[model samples]
Target: MKKIFFTLLFFGCCFLISAQTEPKVGDELIIEAQDGPTYHHIKFPKLNILVKRGKVANYKSVHGNVVIIDDVITDKDNNTYVVLKKKDGSKFFGYLTKVKANYEKSIASGEMVVKS
Candidate 1:
């Protein structure tokens, strides 16, 4: 029983790691939104964008080998914006509006200004 459990756990961990999408910096992706249906040309590994009622499907574009591990994004006064920082050191601020197919609508408003 112990051997079987260990083997299953190992395989499960391997499968999870393999299933992860490897996106590099400077890669551009054409993302199709599911609900509220908005098309966006997203550049990665730019910033981690939380799409409204949409799942991210990776598109084809340029690939870069540069790996960015720094997630710190601060302004002139040193204020952190989002969880993931803009990879290009640019600023972004807008109100994100989302509408679900089940007729459930949601909106998020905030301000973010990235500093050089």
Candidate 2:
């Protein structure tokens, strides 16, 4: 009994350690240009907000852009929201979409690619 319990515990620990903890702060990611101009998987900042900030909210414009994980916000529900910025420390055209997304989900759907 002891042997069986210890073996199960060891495997559980391994599984937990190998689990994916993606979108960690400071991670470099690339915006993947899916077949369409709009990114349906993840939300982008509102067009009006972008334009109000003297920017253009062109979905195609962000294609292939390299961004860094600037902030990671996790709500009480365990939903994750990531704030991304350009590699140069400048914000994205839309900026702060405040959308809840997991990097694994986006990456799996080809919305974002892990650069580093």
Candidate 3:
């Protein structure tokens, strides 16, 4: 009984950990570019480009890269803006477009498919 309990517990933990999704604000993430102008460009140490939600911007990491759903805050006129702050303390803003995820190859040989 004890052996069976322990085995089930271990597998349960593994399943939960694997199911947890990544990609959060302030997390060092690596996303592969599926399709875009900046395809194959490894954007390292990528941070959240858009501060607010519902915007579009480029998001990259050493292990992964992609142009993800950006939630950038916009003005009253609904013009979106992005703040790209580099590690060197330099900052800039630019317009971005929302792109569909084409391909996502994980750093660990797994795949993620996100559909709206």
38-80, model 2: which lDDT tens digit per residue?
A: 6665677656767688877666767888888778877797767
For residue 112, model 3's alpha carbon misses the true position, in angstroms, by 11
TM-score of each: 0.22, 0.62, 0.29
**How should the candidates be ordered by lDDT, best one leading?**
2, 3, 1
lDDT of 3 at 96: 27
- Candidate 3's C-alpha lDDT? 0.36
Clashes of each: 1, 0, 10
Residue 88 in candidate 2, Cα distance off native in Å: 1.8
Q: Please report the candidate that would top TM-score against the real structure.
A: 2
* RMSD in order of candidates: 14.5, 4.5, 12.4
lDDT by residue for model 1 (1-116), tens: 99999999999999997554233333222212223223122222222353432424332211221222233234586433223223444332222221111100100111111121
Q: After superposition, how far is residue 24 of candidate 1 from its true place, in Å?
A: 10
Give the residue spans of candidate 2 off by over 4 A.
1-18, 46-57, 94-101
- The ten-residue window of minimal lDDT in model 3 covers 83-92
| Candidate 1 residue pairs in clash (backbone atoms < 3 Å) | 25-45
